[model samples]
Target: MGRSGLPPGEDIIILLVEDNQGDVRLLEEAFHDASIANTLYIVNDGDEALDFVKQRNEYADVARPDLILLDWKLPTLSGEEVLKEIKSNSSLEQIPVIVLTGSEAQTDIITSYNNQANAYVPKPVDPDEFIDVIRTLENFWLSVVRFPTHTDED
Candidate 1:
């Protein structure tokens, strides 16, 4: 794990946009088991996730997350729509977004990358495999990758 009291430049904030309660709990458990210290924020739907990213309404004080884990299927707005909006906005485009979904459709995979998702991982149905996937994802994002820095302040 990164050092405690990370400088703003090193902070790893994750925004998770998922609607399934069980999956949310599983993700939380996975993070806990991994002993990661970074902050993780959860939103139940894509529209609200977009609002949070845009810093509207209740999200006005929220920090822009370094990474986003988005589900392809969401209420109100789809993840693809949210991804497009984020990539389209100059201020938000550089933030890495990982598509975390159960869909294995080739079209969804291609479209997610086409819409500028940084990565896509199909959700695993098996409990042990899901944990492994989460661990691998954590390792890749928090250890192996260097993400672009955000200079803007809202």
Candidate 2:
């Protein structure tokens, strides 16, 4: 069980769909600092993230994530596309998705919320602010929110 008391057998899994290596490193450091116990599964592109979530082909053994952090811009399929797919699927729609992007545009924010994103966060330019934002995210989602565990067979 995690510090959040999320059942004894279930694991807290986070799926991060981002392409930037620097951002990935920063997120890793921030999670460490926050002392959140969870498994982070990373994929560079949106298409691969979708495949992992669906447990397709090479990702047959992939575990269902408790939450997803999606980036706006990606190499193959865009983050919006991935979000749409997840929200449209009955089995996956219940999982919370936090749209973490560098985009601060109004249209992007509106679109993200329209697509059933649980929260939208604008990426901070400053490293310290970025870490703080990550910490806040951990505090809210991990410590406060209650997420469902995956039990049904895919």
| Best by the lDDT measure | 2
Largest TM-score belongs to which candidate?
Answer: 2
Residues 68-121 of candidate 1 have per-residue lDDT tens digits of 999999999999999999999988898889999999999999999999999999
TM-score of each: 0.90, 0.93
Which regions in candidate 1 have their CA more than 4 angstroms from the true location?
1-10, 152-154
Candidate 2's displacement at residue 93, Å, is 0.5
lDDT for predicted candidate 1 compared with the true structure: 0.86
Global lDDT scores for all candidate models: 0.86, 0.88
TM-score of 1: 0.90
- Show pairs that collide, candidate 2: none
lDDT of 2 by residue, 1-154 (tens): 4445578655578899999999999998887666657888889998899998898978888888888999998999998999999999998898899999999999999999999999999999999999999999999998888886567664
